[model samples]
Target chain A: MELIKVTIDNKVVEVEKGTTILGAAKKVNVDIPTLCHFKLHDMNIENKPGGCRICVVEVDGRKNLAPACATDCTEGMVIKSHSVRVINARKTVMELILSDHPFECLVCAKSGTCDLQSLAQQLGIRKIHFEGKKSSYRLDTSPSIIREMNKCIMCRRCEMMCNKVQTVGALSAINRGFDSVVSTAFEMNLKNSTCTYCGQCVSVCPTGALTEVDDTARIIRALADPSKTVIVQTAPAVRVALGEEFGMEPGTIVTGKMVAALRRIGFDQVFDTDFAADLTIMEEGSELLNRLGKHLAGDKTVKLPMLTSCCPAWVNFFEKQFPDMLDIPSTAKSPQQMFGAIAKTYLADKMGIKREDLVVVSVMPCLAKKYEAQRDEFKTNGNPDVDFSISTRELAHLIKQTIRDFDSLPDEDFDRPMGESTGAGVIFGTTGGVIEAAVRSAYELHTHKKLPRLNFEELRGLEGIREATIDFDGLPIKIGIAHGLGNARKLLEDIRAGRSHFHAIEIMSCPGGCIGGGGQPLHHGHSSIIKARQAAIYKEDAGKAIRKSHENPDIIKLYDEFLGTPLGEKSHHLLHTEYFNRKK
Target chain B: MATTEIVLKEKQVQQIKDICKQFNNESGELINVLHKTQSLFGYLPSEVQVVIAQELNMSLAKVFGVVTFYSYFTMTPRGEHPIDVCMGTACYVRGAEKVLEEFKRQLKIEVGETTLDGKFSINSLRCVGACGLAPVVIVGDKTYGAVTSADVKNILKEYENK
Candidate 1:
């Protein structure tokens, strides 16, 4: 690789050729403020439209200021990052942006965390020299995301995420000039569009323009209801990311503290979604083994490479984009929905409470879980299995609202039965975890052998897509795992083209499974945070006594007492769901 | 306004597919394909863009973005007799804004909108290379020079009920 020397802010630095001015500046520790330029290093994801001129730096002898984010440095390039001209131009650009933006930072949902607001404060912008009519649009509230396009600064990060990253096709830059804003087709409601409620757009948005629909208040209201039995289930990914909201280090595991917080927040029960993750493995594993058996017997009709339907966004993606191959995915409901189903059915029955009176709330690291809870199929009659689903960020807010010192709280165990989970179930938080959990169970069930080692480290990584062939007593059962929906699209295309040889595939919509999910604490364009969270998940997994989902005592009891057996009639009705063709 | 359904003919659909194929079905050629499709069909509707997106293997939102980004492309159908009211700097200084408003009032439609009867559609153009004829209003192929607010009513009368 070629290297180029550049002088930024009188500091000489040598960087690889094709490195952006922003990259070269970082080598010498010159921090340049930027917006509309986001890159998750090692994930092959970047959104640099060069639309925001806030990161402009003066190039020596150049007539125009170059956007540091998109401008590549050449040999002997002289860049003045904090020159008088550069500062004035940057502040002027910010003022122009603020001129059209609403001054509602005091009450905005993205008040402190907003990238644009921080940039304004970093640049010491106190007054707006340019005031103009701010463009406003109708507020769109979907099941998972809220689209407040009026707050949009035209960064196009969400547009890049929705189109290039996730391939959801739910948002794009529409109109032109001063009236330009990102929107769906005809500015239609996102629920009406092909949006999977993935929330990757919300995750990448720099302003309050895109956000998860705040369901904290609804959860609070449920907690306040004296007649309602509010039980909260926290997803595995939530534990690692929830601590970030409380100013804790990234990847700090706060599972016990989160449980204690939920209890103090007035929940009747605090359970782990990992338990339902175990239940999912039980059902999905059985289904996979049954299919593998049929395929091994030369059953040509059986769909090879059964896709994991544990991700609601992934399910919605295939339903809309690859409707013809809907039958290929395992029908097992997601951990969130399965928890809801079992909570409202078996747990409700055991507690002797009416299903209508039981308010089952889920704290997930995903925004799609909110949509999944509200899915019509997950509801019985008019009552949804899960009454409300809140994000990890919301749980942090709830912890704050409860006025308890999260730092000083005693580590408490989750309530009995539903709280019990194995290391296999807890790994569901990261990419390749769900499939790894399945393989742990499927390997033993198919080959009828207790393997030498439990941990399948070969299946684990932060890669977008991975394929591994595990020997089920020399049967060579191939498994494929894709984290982001874009990667899933590639694997799906290969499957459609008859080039795929995998027996089963695990697909998660977010980049790094639920840990890097949209509803998790914002990663702030840092890939290391996601990597740290993944490491925490593995650490939590290694500390557990039972490492396989099938070995969980609670899950075994549930199957023996309530579910009867994996893929049995009762489990099928409650834990399985069918897909629809949403191609329009 | 609600988009009315237009059942495209087989030949027109084939032409759109062929246009996309001409660009080798690459998503990067979205602008060119949209331009050709818009010129061929007079407008780029959602259904038409959906076809182009499928052919190009791109998302519909992206296709919609390219279609809406350029002012040259539109989703609404153009009328048989399209009216262009120049809103260039010279035209605006020459009271083109008032003339444009008068046309809106007379036609009972906003700029870039067509009449209910599908006879006349109004548009605010930048310039027709006719700054000499400042505040110009072009109806079909004929240009009315130095048009005023009062001239808007007569311009509509020429294309009315024809």
Candidate 2:
């Protein structure tokens, strides 16, 4: 690699030829504050619009301060990051931004974690020098995400993620100059637009401009009602990442602590969404095998590559973009919905409680799960299967609001039946987990032989798209795994063109599956946090005695006592759903 | 601005499709296609922008973003007699703000707005290259030099019958 020497803060540092001054400053530990610069190191996703102008630094020969994020280092370059002139300009630009911004940080949802708030504190800004008419916009609340354009810093991070990374094309920087703001087409509500409610936009927004809808209030109300028996199901991804809120490391596994905290927070029964993940695998695996069998038996009518429907964002994506191939994805509902279905039916029936008296709440690593549970098909007579779905971040807030010491909480086990899960279920938090879980069961059922080894190393990785061929005795099952909606789009287009060769495909909307979900603890463009969470998920999976979904005792009992078989009529009614053609 | 549902002619729709095809329907050439479409349709309403987006294989929001970014583009149709008041340094020093305010009063419309009768629309421009004619106001292509608050009503009366 071509090397260049640059003097940053009077310290000479050698970096690659194309390295930005911001990247080179880390060598000598000189900090240059930035606002609109976001980079996911390993994922090759960077959003540096150079619009904020907060990272302006003085160059010796330049006419004006250059943006450190967009400026590349050249040989023998002299850069001063914190001269009085540069500092004054940076502060002035920040003041201008603040002038147009709303001064309601105390009540803002993203106040504590907001990048702009911290930057103002870092700059020691006491009072605004300039004042103007702050931009006001109509508050837009969708099923999963909320848009408050007044708090927008014009970072364009959400715009980049929506159009470039996720390929959702739902948001863009509209209008110009003082009126310029990121909005949907014609400033229509998100529900009317083609937004998939993936929450990638919410994940990247630096301010309170975009956030997941606050459903914790509704959950709290349900828990306090005397007539209600509120049960909460925490997704597998939440366990690995929820501890980050309490100043713990990114990969800290606090599953038992999370369950204990939930119990103390007034949840009548604290269960695990992992159990439902295993249920999903049972139904999805059986559906995959049935499709593969028919395809093998010369049934051209059946769709070949059966896609996983655990990701609600991926479901919404194919529904809007690939309406013609809607039948390809498996009809199995997501883990959140599956848990709600079982909790409201089989569990409520056993407890002799009315469905109306039982409230089902899910803590997920996804914003789309909120929309998924509220899906019309997942309800009966206007009652949703899952009454409410809160994000991992919101659960942390709720835990803090409960007068309970989250860090000092004692470890506790989940409730019986619904809490029991295998390593296959726990692994569902990561990108390759769902497909690996499905393969474990599909292989044994197809070959009528036990898996020699449980781990399919070929299917496990952080790559955007992966394909592996596992030999099922004499038959080879070609499997495809894709995380991130953009990567999913590639596989989808391949299938649309009859180019895909896989029999089963798993697609998750987030980058690293649920571990990198939009509702997880803010990584702030750090891919390492996501990798650490992925590692913790695998660790949880490896420590379990029962590794496969089919081997779980509770699942077997569930089949025997309640739901008959995997693809039985009862299971189909509770666990399966169909897609809509939202082509407009 | 209200997005009135205007029924575009078959020829107009075919003409937009031909303009998009002229640029090979590349999404990167969105600005150029939008310029052509706007020139043909007088303004880029939602219906016209929707056609461009579908033809270019882009989101309507992206197309709208590009169209709204540059001041040269407009989403609303311009009135029969469009007015432009110079707000450059020279014009401002010569009391252009007073002239603009007078026009808003007489025409009953703010800057970047149209009168109820659709006969006049007012907007502000940086410079008309007529620095000597400071405080200039242009009605369509005709330029009025050294315009004052007193002349605003007379300018409106000139375009009243036309």
Candidate 3:
């Protein structure tokens, strides 16, 4: 890498050749405000279209201002990032954007967190002089996402995230110039498109154009209903990231605070989705062992390299993209759905609550869980097992609306039976977690021996795709892990071509798994936040007394009392699900 | 814009698949494939775009994006005698809007809509590099030079009885 010296705002800095002016300016602590330029370091995802000229900077000897994000630094290049001329140009560009944008900040879902809103404030844009006919489009509301394109600034961040990162090509910049907007095929409903409802687009959107469907209103109504017994289940990933909404540092573990807040918010019972994650490990692990045993016995009928179905987005991805390989994934329901099923059935019976009267709500780190809760297979007699699901961000809003001084709240424990979970279950929040959890339980169950080591550090990281081989008492179990649908596509194509060598493959639609899930607090294009969340998940896992799922006393008792055994008739009815080929 | 649900014929689907195979089904050749498909089918409807998308192994949204970005590829079915009024700078200066309004008045249909008899449809296009002709009106394969609002009736008369 060749280094070049550049002067930005009278501060000299050295950067590699081909480094953008924005990159060189950052080394000298010079802030160049941007709207369209977004990068997720370590994830290899960037959206630098240079379409929004808000990052324009004055350059020596140049006739016109250059976009700092796209302009490369050269030797002895002099740049003025905050010069009056550059600031005036950036303000004009921002004013033009605001002129076309809707003035609904008072009611907008992204009022405080909107990048566009903050940029306007930062630029001191009190009024727009270039106001004209604002482009308007039909508001599209899907089960998991809402598309309010009226607020779109055409930054193309969502388009880049949808196509370049997730590879779920449900959105594209259609039409031309003035009329261009990111939309599905023929401007159709998102439910009808190839969208997996992964919410990766919503995660990257800088404006209110894309957002998770606000299910918090529905949840509040359910909680206010006295006739209904509302129970809330918090997913593992939510524990590590929920505190960020309350001004805590990223990866701050707020499990106890969250439970206490939920209790204050009027929930009759607060449980842990990690418990069902343990339940999933037992059922999915048995299924994996069963399939592996049959494949080793030369049974060509059994499907090798079973995929983990813990992610609803990954499930939807395969159902739409790889319809033929539906049978390859484990039939176990996701931890969210598993919790709902057990809560409506075993827990409801134990507490003497009627099935119809019991309301099961989940706090998940995914938008797909909102769609997953409403899936037909998870319903009985037009009533869903899970009444509804809310994202970790929604949970934070609810806490803010009900509790005061959340940071100073005393630590509280979860309600019995369905609340106790093992370390294996807690680790399901991060990448490589589901597979690692399955291995811990599957190894002991298959060999009928106590494992020497607990943590399989080989199966963890921030890599998009990872492969690890764990020795199960002489049986080398090959495992493949892929986060982000694009990387999952590579593994799926290899499997489709009969080239995959692994025995099990775990796929999460979002990058960095559930810790970096679309419904969590936005990382604002920071990959370090995801890494911190992943580390916090492992920290929570290591602190638990029982690291293996089978060792969880409540999970053991649930199987002994009500479920009978893993993969048994009762467990299959409650814990398993089938996939559909939604190719069209 | 309202679009009616359309189902392509079995043979029409096969034709699209063949055209995609000719282009090696490369997603990069989407524009070329769409042009060829539109030429064969007269227009790129949603049904035809779906077949092309499947053959190319690309998302329908992507194929639709390409089809919509260019003015040449249309989703609606064109009339037997499609009328295109050049709305370029040169043509606009030479009473192109009046010529377009006259055609729309005679056809009893809007710019993108076809006549009830399916004989004529109107569309406004950019420059056709026929600046010397100024206001040019194209009907089917015939081009009328320096066309006026009065010439609109004559152009419709030529398409009639054919």
- Largest lDDT belongs to which candidate? 3
Error of 3 at A340 (Å): 1.1
Local error of candidate 1 at A385, Å?
A: 1.4
Model 3 clash pairs are none
Best of the two (1, 2) by lDDT: 2
Model 3: per-residue Cα lDDT over A224-258, one tens digit each: 99999999999999999999998999989999999
Tens-place lDDT digits, model 2, residues B1-162: 356678778898899999999999999899899889878876788889888899999988898888878766778887888898999999999999999999888877888787888888888888878999998999988999999999998888998789
TM-score of each: 0.96, 0.97, 0.98
Interface root-mean-square deviation of model 3 in angstroms is: 0.9
Task: Please give, for residues A50-122, the per-residue lDDT of candidate 2 as tens digits.
Answer: 9899999999999999999999999999999999999899889889999998889989999899999999989
Structure candidate 2, residue pairs in collision? none
Q: Ten-residue segment with the worst summed lDDT in candidate 1 chain A?
A: A395-404
Q: Worst 10-residue stretch by lDDT in candidate 1 chain B?
A: B1-10
Assign candidate 1 its CAPRI class: medium
lDDT tens string, model 1, A438-468?
A: 9999988878899778789889998888989
Model no. 2, DockQ = 0.74
